[model samples]
Target: MQYVRLGKTGLNVSPVAFGGIPIQRGTAEDTKAIVDKMEELGMNYIDTARGYTVSEEYLGAALQGRRERFILATKSMVRDCSGMKKEVDVSLEKLRTDYIDLYQIHNIKTADFEQVFGEEGAYKALLEARHEGKIGHIGITAHSIDDLKTILSEHADQIETIMFPFNLVEIQGEAALKEAKAKDIGTIAMKPLAGGNLEDWRLALRFVALSGTCDISIPGMGDVEEVEKNASVCCDLSPLTEEERTEIERLRKELGNQFCRRCGYCAPCTVGIDIPTNFVFANYLRKYGLADWAKDRYASLKVNASDCIQCGVCEERCPYDLPIMDMLKKVEEDFAR
Candidate 1:
């Protein structure tokens, strides 16, 4: 496995980090098998979030006697000092470890830094926790460049790493990754497969590995074949052929502007609809061949696409300027049928 220095944290991590989201869908035995394979392949960085259900717990259980063999990172979404402190304690307990290699503020949006770093903010708790030996390093994650820049500028002293969605389709992260590198903050690229929208695994993995900014790209691996394939890509940093590059470009063009990257920028909707989540379910139905599953999941949402009130508020906030209301209407109609 190829190892890269993770910015100021000084941790040399493998190019292929283990993303914990997909493990939530697997049984404990399956998760253990995948993780054991990852470790065997020398992929040492494991990232999970408190919001990813039992992912951290399962990883903790899997790594019980082998904690020193890997770099474990987890995150919490708490914005207050007390809540942040409490969450970190719970995470430490769940992970069966006293010190986390990296602890992060999860899915930070535009207003998150100001909210978490301000007076009486969560950074106070994080700093205290760090000093108390609960976590070794601090990190922040976001889906937008704007939020990333804001965090870097405002809390550069406190942040040792940052995570963001980076894939062949969203090349916009390149600049942000460069900036983070310059600031000596480790950059972890999430959604390296475009949330499984990219059909060709080789092209997707090669694109991310060649990006030059990603110290580690964490693709959600759920099965043994996936682990082997990802490990193979990491072990051999081979570039894509001309024909493969052309095919990737064609696929990107076909996906077009309507593809929701799920940045969650169009949030706090006036009508209370979960815009990003609705789009996720729509994509699962259209691309992932989980139409029935997506429909059932969408129907369970308290505020679904069906609740969209035709307001253009979400569109105005979207950086991509997606016609969210129309899309939601289409989702409601398509899934209902």
Candidate 2:
């Protein structure tokens, strides 16, 4: 596997890190098998979060004797020093490690920065942890361009790494990511596959790696085959050919700007709508040419898009500022036909 220096952190890491979100869908044994494959290929970097249910615990169990082989990274949503300090201890305990290579402020926004970087904010706690040898570096993850812009411009000296969504279609973060890279802050492409919207995983990953903006891309992997596929791409880093470049344009035009990234920030829908799932099925029906399967899946949902009461609650939480009510209305209309 190919390795790159993770910005100022000075940690040599795999170009394609192992994203730990998908493991929650599997069993402990399944996680072990997945981690076993990652170890076999020397993937060497694992990114998980406190919010990803059971991901930290399962990864901790799987890392067992091999914890030192990989650079472990995780994030939390708390914004205060006390809360973040407690979270660091919890993450260490859950990850079954004495030291974490990277600890991040998860999904930070422009409005939360004042409090987060305050005298008694999460940043203080992370600095304290790094000083005490509990964490090696500090990073931030965000879905907003404004937030990334702020970090790269004014707060670049404060953060060692910055993660944001980057894919063939979602190149909105391109300029900011480039700026971050220029500043020597590790730039990680979070939704490298456009939240599973892109079918050509090889092209999707290659686009980000060759883009010159991002240092690494973390595509969520649940199985050994996925690890093998993503690792193979990293090992054989090549420029996109003319045909692939043309295909990239086609995908960008086809997906447009309104599609969901499946970040799941728009949760606890007032009416219990599985918002991302609805969008996924809709995409399958419209884009994947799987109308019957998509219809079946939508039918199985207890509350589909058509059931949306248009309460506007989800739109408030969506970091991308997508018009959720209107998008769901379109999904409802498409599935009705």
Candidate 3:
């Protein structure tokens, strides 16, 4: 497998890192088999989060005796120092590990770093924990490339890694990746396959790897076949040919303009609806076989598409300029049945 240096951490991670989300859907034995296959293929970096239910526990059980063979990275969404410390301790116990290779502030979106890095914020707790030998490196994951750039510039001394969404559809991180490389901060690419919307895994994986900015890609692989296919792509670092690129372009065009990028730029709905989340559940209902669960979750939303007041405010703010009212209407019509 192709090994790349994980920025300032100085850790050599396989280009294809194992993502622990999909494993939560499988049986323990199934999860164990997938982990074993990844280990056998020399894919060492494992990324999970406390947000992903049962993922850490299953990975902990799978890697029980082979913990030393992999680099474990997990995240927490807690914003306070005490809560952050508690979450880390819980994660350690669940993972059956004494220390995590990387502990990250998960899904950082708001400009709360001033509060986060302040004396009472979680950053101080992370420093104390690291000094006490609980975490080896500190990192942050964000959906916005701009936020990551800002964080890197402000806290370059404390931040060892940065995780951002990098996929075939959204090549938004080219500049951020360059900056991370220049600063020697490890770059982790999430959604490498465009949240499984892109069907061509080979082309998608190759494109990200060839960018030279991606140190490791943590694609969610729930089965052994997926693990092998992903590992094979890393094992052979082949770039996509012109013909393949043309085909991908054609597919993108054919898929048309209905896909939601989940950027959430059109947010703070007047009716208090979560626009991106509604679209996410809608996509899962259509693409995957979680229709029942999606419907239940959709029903539980405080303000779903059905509650949209057709204000046109969200559409005006959308960078993609998507027809928010029309899409929400469709979601209401389709999922509310």
Candidate 4:
């Protein structure tokens, strides 16, 4: 199995890496067993996050004796210099590593650009961490294609990698991701399975691997079987077969209308709600069955789906013409239960 380089960071990682979101639902021992499988399979990249509850802590415990065997990565949502500085230290503490291979600004948005790259912003802290050898490279994760383009256009020089959702059904960021590849910025696919919306693991992973847009795809693995399954895809990044392309097209057409790609096109809710993020939480709650985790994230939203004014303004902006008002109602119903 040939490893792939993660953009200009120069870190060679397995094309199908371990995503740590599911670790929150498992025990430390479960994480350890999964890590053992990854090590045996030679899956050398592990991506976790500070926002994923105990994910970093669990992975840290799992990597106890063999931390050097994998290139570890984690991200935080902190925006300021002091907060980010503290977050980096906390990530190191939780990951059980003195150094992180890649540290990303998690789920960055357009409004976050100023504070993230400002004089006293998170970027400043990351730079200091890099200088101190606490972090190897800096990166950013975004849910919007426009935000991804903004990064490539203005902040490509400030970061080494970019993580965005890339799957057959969620290819809105495809062009920007290709631009990232051209700019020598590492591209990481965050939701290869469309947040559990895609049931065919092999097809989902293979599509990302052969897309030529993302350098690596991190499918959140909750168990040893998932780890092994995703690892198997790494051995074959060959072009998708004609039949596979047809299958992808079919799946897209089937799931397209109802699925929220989190493209951020439907923004500025009448009641100050974050439209795409609400869909994301609902996905985790309903699809992943992580009810508590999803509800907690949903609660963190300043505006709940129940508050949607249903003015239809967001729907007008959505390229997909998704029923944003009705979707918000479903989200509210799900959380209410």
In terms of lDDT, which candidate is strongest? 2
Per-residue CA lDDT of candidate 2, range 262-287, in tens? 88999999999999999999988897
* lDDT (10s digit) by residue, model 4, range 16-98: 99989888888999999999999999999999988888999999999998999999999998999999999999999998889
Candidates in descending lDDT order: 2, 4, 3, 1
Which digits, one per residue and each the tens of the lDDT, describe model 1 over residues 291-314? 899988998998898888877888
Model 4: residue 38 alpha-carbon error in angstroms: 0.3
Which ranges of candidate 3 are over 4 A from the true structure? 251-258, 261-326, 331-337
TM-score of 4: 0.82
Q: Which scores better on TM-score, 2 or 4?
A: 2
Is 2 or 3 the stronger prediction by lDDT? 2
Candidate 1 — which pairs collide?
none
Alpha carbon lDDT at 1, candidate 4: 59
After superposing candidate 1, which stretches have Cα over 4 Å from the reference? 261-323, 332-337
Error of 3 at 127 (Å): 1.5
- Backbone collisions counted per model: 0, 0, 0, 0
Report lDDT (Cα) of residue 254, candidate 3: 56
TM-score of each: 0.84, 0.98, 0.82, 0.82
Model 3, position 295, has a per-residue lDDT of 92
lDDT of each: 0.84, 0.92, 0.84, 0.89
